[model samples]
Target: MLKAGDKLPQFEGLNQDGETVRSEQLIGKKLVIFFYPQANTPTCTVEACNLSDNYSKLEKAGFQLLGISGDSVKKQKNFHSKFAFPYDLIADESHEILEKFGVWQEKTTFGKTYMGIVRTTFIFDEKGICERVIEKVTSKTAAEQILEA
Candidate 1:
């Protein structure tokens, strides 16, 4: 698992617009990469909106935000359009990114166990070194926590 001070693993993925987003592009900016299960769900919506609400602040603080999920580009595009989020939403349908970041895991809900992506966020500084890893994220407060980190 990634932790504070560890260099982030290099990655390349497509944004909501199907544009390329690479780790190299984030060379000199603080990055807040949050991983969620899917788009348009209750918790995911809350998390995305919460970050959207404070996007200006995060930008002002020199942070570039990105969200990743296993959802398709079409679904992500719709969610982005509806919420008007000014950040990148990467499509990770193959689960490669999820596995790379160690967010893919076996989870249990109401006595049923299954594999899924755990909601988590990684904070990386301009140097691409992780500054914080939020393992237990509350959708509403996630942005504030990243800001503080």
Candidate 2:
């Protein structure tokens, strides 16, 4: 996992609309990049909606939010549209961005081990340096966690 002060890796991803979004575009502003396991899951939905609910506050604080998951563009589009989220959701089906950020990992459930994304969030400053890493994310208060961090 990346720690505070580490430089963010250069990455490009496809957003819900199939538009290319590159890390360079976010370099000049504070950014919140969150990795969720999948789209439309209960926990993920709560987390995303919380962020969306508090989006104005986050924007007011100069933070741009991006959500990523191993879902396809069509799935991402549906998720974004269903929730009416104001931010973009990256369709990282290849796990390129997830692996780059080190969120893809071995997870355990019901005594079974499997590879999946560990829900995590990274805060990057204007210069693209990681400022904070939130590994224990509170799904319902994600924006508050970011704002308070």
Candidate 3:
């Protein structure tokens, strides 16, 4: 996983709106890139909605946020619209962005092993250097976690 001081990995992907978003364009912005396993699931929804509710706080802190999951563009669009998220949600259907950020991993659930995303958040500075990483995310207090970090 990327750690403090690591540079943001170059990536290009489609947002919920089907508009293209690229890593290069985020160069001069303090950013938060959150990787969630799936969209609209209970925990994911809580986490996303918490961030959405705190959108103004995050924006006032000079941070631009991006939520990402392995769902398709249509799914992401629905999730975004359902909650009116202020940030972009990247449709990481190819898992390319997930892998680059090292959030994609093997896991075991109910004695079954599978590959999936481990909910994680990366905080980056204006110059794109990673400033912090939150691996054990708290859905209800996700915004506070980012703000306090």
What are the lDDT scores of the predictions, listed in order?
0.91, 0.96, 0.96
| Candidate 1, 49-95: lDDT as tens digits | 99999989889999999999999988989999999999989999998
TM for every model, in the order presented, reads: 0.96, 0.99, 0.98
Say what the RMSD of model 1 is. 0.9
lDDT of 2 by residue, 8-124 (tens): 889999999999999999999999999999999999999999999999999999999999999999999999999999999999999999999999899999999999999999999
Compute the lDDT for candidate 1: 0.91
| Per-residue lDDT value at 147 in model 2 | 98
**Residues 16-58, model 3: lDDT tens digits:** 9999999999989899999999998999999999999999999
**Runs of candidate 2 exceeding 4 Å displacement:** none
